[model samples]
Structures are given as structure tokens and as C-alpha cells.
Target: MKKILILFLSIVIFSCKKEEKGFSDYLRSLDTLVLPQKFSLNSTMNSSNKYDSILFKKYKHRWTYAPYGIAFNNERIVGIIEYSIADNGLAPFLITFDNNGNKIDSLNILGNSSFGMKGQTLESAILDTNLKLVVIDSSKSWQVDIDANKIPNTTKLRVSTTIYKIQKNGKIKKIK
Candidate 1:
């Protein structure tokens, strides 16, 4: 009985130490991440679930997080993390963290949706070197004539653009 208890305690202690080291190593790796001038969220890209426990603490069990890219300024670390709920498509978010790996703020980068009978909307974002983010949203809706066997009558397409700035202090500000 004594030997069995000792073995179990040893395993638990070693596992805890490994988890602590993994978290710090992960944060250091973020500093070396290379980001492109224009990046679109790719759902097929490989993802790490190591930080899911830390980052998605309050999220539902069906949600998953994937780190897209990371940028470093003098004061903060900006990272793009993609989230997916269940089997739904991925959505990217720009999350800011302090130097010690504490989350400061976050903003959704893009979200696309399709309305079966009403309309559909698509969104995308581009991040420039100066920490400027531009989000473009395009939507389309059509009028359906129920009397005509639900045939489409008229369609309207709308496009809009919004801009945001990620400041050095880990804050996201909407500039447009």
C-alpha cells in the first residue's frame, strides 16, 4: 500500500510540473511567431490545444481554440486565435496579452453567416504592419415571391468597411 501511494503521488507531482513548464514554453514560442502582411483564417491549419484550458476557461466544451499568429510591440503581445464551436466554421479573434501571458483584451476579426431564406453575410479582415486592422463585410439579400413558388425577385448587395487599431497598451480601438 505504501509503495502504491508513493507512485501515485510522484506521478501527480511530475504532471503538475510538466504543465507549468509547458505553459511558459508556449508563451516564449509566441514571441518568435512570424505573421504575414495579410492573413486569412485557414480552418485546415494545424492547431495546438495546450492553451485551451487557460484561454477558453469560460467557453463551452464544444469550442476549440487555435493560435493563428502573434505580434509583439514594446508593451504587449498581440495574437490571433481562431475559435470554432462544435463543427461550425472557424472565427478569428485578435487577442492582446501582457508580457507575462495575461489576457488584456480581444476583438473578433471576422464572422461569416448564411441565412437560408433571408440573406447571407461574409466578413474578412486585413492586418497591416502598423497594427491597423480593416474588416470588410459584404451581405446579400433577395426578395422571394411566395406566390411564385418562392422564386427570387430582387436582390440587394451591400458592403461596408470598419477599421481598428491595436494600441501598445493591449487595447483595441475602433478607428472607423
Candidate 2:
């Protein structure tokens, strides 16, 4: 009887252990997370700059739900880009957190022209050899005639491509 009881308790204790979510798990769950539109400066930068910014996500003058892509460094930073499809545009933002998933900051990248992350849906994000955040932006736009209900014969299609690198301090520097 004691042996059986001990075995049952051991099983219960092992089953009760919670599984921790990793960075990859967070990336897979991005579609369900509502990203913050604005962010305060990080502590390291806040003391020197005292900066604040408001960000926006809109396509064709209307607000929409867009989940594009996410990238993580497995340590401190995660960047995500959401895109709107009415015409074509991207809203990229950076999220910083501690090892315990405590949010540090959510800095907007789409607002910065130097980031070159606007006007396209982010395709992919990865950390490069230099540990800089590298992202690829792509989009396709076509002009249509409302009266004809078809694309205009003379209308030209527009495609934009941008590759960007984000620095460690949350500032974006255009790469291509």
C-alpha cells in the first residue's frame, strides 16, 4: 500500500510541472497577440534621450488586423511586422523583453523612413552575422477602375522591395 501511494504521488508531482514557452513558441503565437502601437524608450536609452512616439497601422485609410512576421534573437529582442492589404503597406515594430518574458519596450519601426520598412508586408526577419536585425519587405499593388470593375489596361503595377537592418538601440538603418 505504501509503495503504491508513493508511486502515485511521484506521478502527480511530475505531471504538475508547467512547460515554459520558448521564443519559437511566441513567434508561432503572434497572430493571436495584439501588438502595442506605441512604446516608451528602453532604460538604457531613456536616461539620455527621454523619447516617446505614437505609431499607427492603416491601409487604404482604414484600420485592419494584420500579422506579418516575427524575429527573435533568443535573448532580449523580438521584432514583428504587420501588413494591411487594401493597397499595400507594412507596420513594423520591435519588442524587447527579459528572459522571463517581461516586456521591456515596443518600438515602432514603420514610422522611420530610414528603416525602409513601409509600403510592404514584411516577408521574413532574422539575425544576421553581425547580430543586427535583418528584415525583408515586399509588396504588390495594382490600379483598378471602379467604373469598369477591372484593372485598367494602362495602369501599371507597382512592386517595392526593401531590406533593412535595425541597430541594438532600436534605431533602424536602411541596408538596401
Candidate 3:
């Protein structure tokens, strides 16, 4: 009788245990992302609902999150997530994880700004085979001197570039 009771309790306990997903599971769930890809504010990419659910549950943020791509090397897994809120354009982020599913670091791949008549900023990013991310930002701003026709004058233009490299240990380092 004691053996039967113990067996019943064991069965109940084991049956109620939930399965936890690890980083590899999440990585496997994503489609392989081709390298030498480009991303911009207007770029469109397909996403997985399951991956999005996992990301959202793990890291809660007010902005809507979409998984863009996945890539891995010998030491780490890199995932790109695009997040956006109302009025703000889409932005890409690079998140790195260790072999055991631990998050090592995250970086926003582009600069965020509001574009308008007075000033406008355009940003784009390119990921290469060497795990280098190059971001280019072009901005134009003009003095608000309205002419007789109520048109703003163009005064200045600025362009900047930033480079980032993914280290073997899953750390994102800004190289330039």
C-alpha cells in the first residue's frame, strides 16, 4: 500500500513539472539569417510568432518586438530584434547569448530620431560576413527662416558612420 501511495505522489509531481526552453531551443526555432544583409527603417522582414512570444516573455518591454534574424558562431548566438512604438520608426537591436542561453549583451544598431520639416535624419545598417555592423546616418537641418513663400531654407548636412564588431564571447564592441 505504501509503495502504491508513493508511486501516485511521484507521478503527480512529475506530471506537473513544466518544460523549460533554453537558448539553443530558441535559436533552433528561428530561421537561418543570410549574411551581408541590410536593414533600414522601412525594411520589411518575416517574423515568427513563437520566437516573438519567447522574447517578449523573457524581456518585457512596452514597445512591440519582432524577431528579425538569427546567426551563430562557435561561441555565441546573435539575434536581431526590431522594436517600435507609436510615432517612432522601427529600430533594430543585436542581442547576444552564450551557449547555455544566458544573455551577454545587447546593442541598438541605429540612432533614433524624429524627422520633420526643420530637420530629418536617415539611418541604415549593414551586417557583413565578418560579424561587422556598419551604421550610416545622414542628417539635414536648416534654419527656420521662412521666406516670403513660407518655405524653410536648407542650411546644413551632416553624415556619420559607426562600426560594431561582435566578439567571440558574445560581447558587442563598438569599433568605430
Candidate 4:
């Protein structure tokens, strides 16, 4: 009779232990999950300094959603040109897309008059304000200042950001 009671108590304790588990434990039981790609690189630079910008998806000029180079103005994509000026010199590039995947708009980001980037430098790039653009070199960060027309009777805030380059080895090093 004692054995039977002890076994019953152990089973009850084990059952209660399962009930004590929390949400985190329940989540851990899930299998490895993967997320789909929302966006992708539309195009890359033709040379080191000279880049050609192109949007991945196609969309007409949209007023509702603002579109930037190689990014979605809306659910669709629009093309753009990119240029970078660093201590190394200047890189002027034009990247555009064809009716399909073909690349067009061949313009060196930094003009030929200037020295371009050394190697694969631009890991990522972004444009701020209406005219100003920014590029993150392997060693340093650069900000492009552009003057543009703002909203009616409103003060404009100038924003700046710093970007780093990811090495081929998957390591990030700050550009000068």
C-alpha cells in the first residue's frame, strides 16, 4: 500500500512539473525558422569608385510613398545614380535598370577627373535629405550636403549618420 501511494505521488509531481513550464519553454520547443527576403541589392558598382544604381522592383513615380535609389518608392522599385567623395578622391557612378535585369545608365560615381576607390569598398550606402547622399568607405564615413527645397514655412532638420564597411571575411572595419 505504501509503494502504491509513493508511485501515485511521484506521478502527480511529474504531472505538475509540466504545468509549471512557462511560455519561453514552450517557444524553445519550436523548430528553427527562416525569414523571407523583403529586399535585395538591385545593382552594384561597375568599378571601384564608379557605381551604377538600379532598383530591384519596378514602380512608377509615386507621391504616396517616397522612393530612393535602389529602394522601393512603393511596392515597386525606381532607379538612381550614386556618387561618393572620400579622402581617396571621388567616385561618380550611375546605376540604372533596363526593362528587365540588364544594367543601364553607365556613369562613374566619381568622375574620371578624380581618383576612385581602391577595391570593393561600398558594403552599404544610403542617401539622406533630398539631394545629399552618403557612402561608407572601408575606412571612413562621408556625408554629402545638398541644398533642396523644403516644405512651406517649416524648418528643416539636417541629419547625418556614420556607416561601416564589412570586410570580405565578414568582419567590419571603420573607414577613416
- In model 1, the runs with Cα more than 4 Å from the true position are 1-19, 29-33, 37-44, 48-63, 85-88, 112-114, 147-153
The order of the candidates by lDDT, greatest first, is: 3, 1, 2, 4
For model 1, what is the error of residue 90's alpha carbon versus the real structure, in angstroms, after optimal superposition? 1.7
lDDT of each: 0.60, 0.41, 0.69, 0.31
lDDT of 2 by residue, 1-176 (tens): 99999999999999999885454454554542232222212111111121111112211112323434444444555554443322223434555444444445554443332212122233444444453544443443344466534454543334344455555644456676
- The residue pairs that clash in candidate 3, if any, are none
**Best of the two (3, 4) by TM-score:** 3
Best prediction by lDDT = 3
Task: Kindly list the per-residue Cα lDDT of model 1 for residues 23-43, writing each as its tens digit.
Answer: 345554342334444433444
Q: lDDT, candidate 3, residue 83?
A: 52
Q: Point out where model 3 deviates above 4 Å.
A: 59-64, 85-88, 146-153
The sequence of per-residue lDDT tens digits that candidate 3 reaches over residues 1-176 is: 99999999999999999888765676666667778878787866666545647644564223436666575546446555545433555676777766665677787666545577577788899989898889888888776645523244555889999898988877888999
| TM-scores for every predicted model | 0.67, 0.34, 0.81, 0.21
What is the descending TM-score order? 3, 1, 2, 4
Report per-prediction Cα RMSD to one decimal.
6.0, 14.6, 2.9, 20.3
Q: For model 3, what is the alpha-carbon lDDT of residue 93?
A: 71
**Which one wins on TM-score?**
3
